[model samples]
Target: MNDTTPDSLIPYDEIVQEALRAVVGRVLGQVEDAGGVLPGAHHFYITFKTGAPGVSVPPELRARFPDEMTIVLQNKFWDLAVREEDFTVSLSFNQMPSKLVIPFSAITAFVDPAVDFGLQFQAVEEDEDDLASAENDSANGASERDVASRITSSEDGSNVVSVDFGKKK
Candidate 1:
């Protein structure tokens, strides 16, 4: 019995999760305010679940990244659209242009390597009742983990704000 950790009646985990997700929203909102342009060398690497509901992607992309996919938003990206619950962007892959629409709920990680800042989040399912269920993802030919893994920080690095809801099943 560890007295150090006390249980609470409040759903602290859910509260904190929502708050942290807001951080991503706010940052994107800021970028949208700044004429849809990334400031200076600041760029982003956003990773989200491909099959999560509300996620819209090209057939080839969904085929390439059947489970989780990471996109780079630095120099070549265009049509950066941010909404209340989701964002859409256009990027080129293998010299082929593609558009991706991903809800924040599907995002597992967001990283700005230029600033050495990152955020790791717990991956949730589109269905409430399927939260703990794992799909036999063909993307990587394996079942993806529900937790986001931190990427190795850059040379000019800092700490990543990662959240763990302790809901792993």
Candidate 2:
């Protein structure tokens, strides 16, 4: 008997990533619908590429997080709005308020450390490279303090999850 497997015509990785991001949207939407009271230990830590398209972060924030950033969506967050392709929220840092709008495609990881639940998605093509380039560019253009502040070591070393939808006949 010979083994035969067909190549995938559909982009399963992208599709799964989209669905996973919708989970983020739906979860945030639920919190927004419920007036920002997160249901029992259900806070999120969302990490995304800073330079990805559709990421609307302030210039100061972009300067501070030139490559990737992880945001905690816990008790302090406010004004969350979820749309079809993206979501926006208000968070505070150093007693200063900042608003961030992130598209689903830009998200790389979502974790609820309280329950030890996490989801990691593959970064969109070119976006990953762009993030690396952005970090290099920032390091060259900005002060040492600025570059140092933006560095985050990935404790979870696993890269994005890739899914294949191809099947064997």
Which candidate has the highest lDDT of all? 1
lDDT per residue (tens digit) for residues 114-145 in model 1? 66788766776644533322232322222234
Report, for every candidate in turn, its global Cα lDDT versus the true structure: 0.69, 0.68
Off by over 4 Å in 1: 1-8, 126-157, 167-169
Candidate 2 structure quality by residue, lDDT tens digits, 1-169: 7688656787776677778788878888888899988888776767778888899988988888877777778778889988998899898866789899999888776656555556666665444344332132221134333322233323545222334343655
Best prediction by TM-score: 1
Location of the lowest summed lDDT over 10 successive residues in candidate 2: 132-141
Q: Model 2 reaches what TM-score against the true structure?
A: 0.72
Q: In model 2, which regions exceed 4 Å deviation?
A: 1-6, 126-169
What's the number of clashes in each of the models? 0, 0
